[model samples]
Target: MSSPQPPPHSSPTQGAPPQLEQLFHSYGAKIYGLALRCGLAPKDAEDGVQEVFLKVQRRLGTFRGEAALSTWLYQVALNTLRDHRRRVVRQTRATEMSTLSPQAADPHFVAPGQSPVEQASVEERRQIVRLALDRLPHKFREVLILRELQGLSYRDVARILQIRQGTVESRIYRARERMAKELKKLGVEG
Candidate 1:
């Protein structure tokens, strides 16, 4: 089978463009998840998603499919979030680091349909995990999030991160090792 051709640049006289909508349908969740994992709060994550697609739409017409669509989408999402992060410094909670507001402690995406007790337990555990993840060094945290959370292949991550595959493998190894230490410090049993 042939590779995907880039989208046409001309203004179609027809209805809404199909390619952007189709791209959103296919990659939207992954983009959102990536942004959230990158440390954007929920609202910022939402805005980042919009910004990512805007960038994606602007250039996807020329995206020659040199890489997989997912790789391109991941690259766009990562760059957009990194750029946004540099410009926006959100205020932290007024409470001490030792204290977490109940609502603030909930994970960005909570699993539904669990019993109330199960939900609370899960939320607490998620909060602990999130705390540990946040405490990790940025490079290690990123590698862990992409490899463990996103489940992207080492090669795919290397392409998106523009690093060597050997570097991806070594970094992922170091990331996991550090994450385990972080979790242990958070009182999680690993």
Candidate 2:
């Protein structure tokens, strides 16, 4: 008798084509980094990574090989981030009227004893980088994050963002220039 086969809609098995674990092992860190660059908090980034992987799992069979696998993953991650941002915006708007008035204290101030000096320095630098990133227009920051931080090729970024490769290259250049200027102001050269 022939062995039974799992249904087509079931998750791919270890012996199946296009091993999902292997794909996750190779691209997971890049996906998490991209999620972080998308302005997600650490926990939110983790959630976004999980969400992207779930998406990859569901859609892997339909991948037609027109784009690199990494490019497809990037697109999945970016869409996840966009969804997260929209949810956050909606929640913020819903809570806006009931929130208390803002205090005059610096929002970025970290309380003493909260972290060690070295940790604090790292956190401060992260804050500075995030501030610089926030200053960038969305298009520039997206390209910079995908190209520089995630280490994706310009071609992959263009494919993920649905823009021309030249546009990705130019936007990354301008984004880096703007980030450099902002970093200089923050005493974080380079």
Candidate 3:
């Protein structure tokens, strides 16, 4: 018998092996939208997307092709988002628990706009929206983001979040009620 041939190293681009560029092209917008809904700043969301793709690149060979490509991508994106959110929460808690204060103000606080009044109003609205979102429990907030912001179908949200469709619907309803209450407090009835 001829000498045993070693198994070929899987080439990165052979026959739909989930190339990094293709993955980004297909899922970039969804991942970014998810990151935004995760309450990350725009820059942080961008970085999260990049970091997610890096993980995808590293883990591509391990994908078994059992699920749809989109499903796998969403799973990766969700994991990355959770990791980033955990890091941010830890950092925030640490800062809140710290006594040391820097002399200089944080540059991230600067508002962008024309007049001070306009900027103030914009900032106020943003604050109100954020407060409303914060008032929601995690399950509710997630359903609202997936349904309203991300425009996911209830079925899709259920699938992605591993919840029953009825649960998704109920959580979304509760989230809307909580958001309305918060908005009413902010003098924005609707």
| Winning candidate number (TM-score) | 1
TM-score of each model, paired residue for residue: 0.73, 0.66, 0.69
Residue 34 of model 3, lDDT score: 83
lDDT of 3 at 44: 69
Per-model lDDT: 0.77, 0.74, 0.73
Q: Which candidate, 1 or 3, would have the higher TM-score against the true structure?
A: 1
- Could you give the C-alpha RMSD of every candidate to the true structure, in order shown? 9.0, 8.6, 8.7
- Find the 10 residues in a row with the least total lDDT in model 3: 98-107
- How far in Å is the alpha carbon of 170 misplaced in model 1? 0.8
User: Given candidate 1, what's the lDDT at residue 135?
Assistant: 79
Task: Give lDDT: candidate 1, residue 40.
Answer: 70
Backbone clashes in model 3, listed as residue pairs: none
Best lDDT goes to which candidate? Answer: 1
Error of 1 at 146 (Å): 1.4
| Candidate 1, 1-190: lDDT as tens digits | 9999977767476533688889888888888777777767667777888899999888888788899888888888888887765444333344323322223333455566787788778888877777787777777777887888788899998998999999999998988888889889988998
lDDT of 2 by residue, 40-108 (tens): 665666777888888888898889999888778778779887787556546657987411112111346
Model 3 residue 64 CA deviation (Å) reads 5.0
Per-model tally of clashing residue pairs: 0, 0, 0
Better of 1 and 3 by lDDT: 1
Instruction: Evaluate residue 123 in candidate 2 and report its C-alpha lDDT on the 0 to 100 scale.
Output: 70
